[model samples]
Target: MGVYNVHERLLVARSGEVGALLDTLSSGGDGDALWPHRSWPPMRLDRPLAPGAAGGHGPVRYTVTTYVPSAWVRFAFSGPRGFHGFHEYVVLPVDEERTVLRHTLAMNTGGPARLTWPLVWRPLHDALLEDSLDRAERACTGAVAHPARRGAYTRLLRRLLRRPPGVTGKP
Candidate 1:
């Protein structure tokens, strides 16, 4: 069981604006310009973002466990085995012109996660979150000093995963 948290502060946007940005991502993904940098898989909920709503992307399935409008939302994983916990987004206001956005993943990895987490999941997660925050910053400030770039490791992992399993690693 491990509790992992990641966050970003929007120094140039208001709480409502940041909330709306997050809502846009939650509802329809970040589109082409920002898709690759999302912290979470492109979510596609069957219903609206609210408590008890069910949805997932890729290999993950979850049910919304909590929702507090533009402030917070949590989803509890229901599949992929050994993953028992929830991931959530929280929005906190720093001032009338600034906001803090956070994402938290708290779970107990039982089966493969214990191993996969350290070797693969953690690295990918960190990269993705930082990239997502970079996009957020760009959205708020109209520019970012340094943009996120997928490195060799991330690219290799993506390529490997895209290959059909047990294919002798030839692609």
Candidate 2:
């Protein structure tokens, strides 16, 4: 529960859309990234009903947990060998357009690693969080350069069926 390298900043020239971007990333995490996550359905995360589902960018109360890739989960599980839970927090400006994003990776411990958190964990966490923020910024700015865009399931099925012989096992 103690502080672990907390940071807060304003993105200046960008705030509203930026805030929207943060909300999208924080709330749109479904176990499967391929699905149409930006919606309110069984597949999509249900925002936490604790605070209330009214957000400046949109309506949402809470999400069960932000979706990190299996790889991230694996790293969190293996790299730190004690305790088990690290949740993220996406804080938006209460009044301004800027968003205050916090990815607090926490755990319960008093082991050797805990002793070295200042020296080791801080640096590791810093780098990881930096990458996360950078990506979030890209999504905010509509400049996510290149990562294959999502398409409908039926479209993919059709494409697979229409593939040339060389593209598939058909002869």
Best by lDDT: 1
Minimal lDDT window, size 10, model 2: 69-78
Give me candidate 2's TM-score against the actual structure.
Answer: 0.40
Model 1: per-residue Cα lDDT at residue 94: 93
Residue pairs with backbone atoms closer than 3 Å in model 2 (clashes): 15-97, 47-62, 48-62, 48-63
| Each prediction's whole-model lDDT (CA) | 0.70, 0.39
Taking all chains together, the TM-score of candidate 1 against the true structure is 0.80
Model 1 misplacement above 4 A: 29-41, 163-171
Query: Cα deviation of 89 in candidate 1 (Å)?
Result: 1.1
TM-score of each: 0.80, 0.40
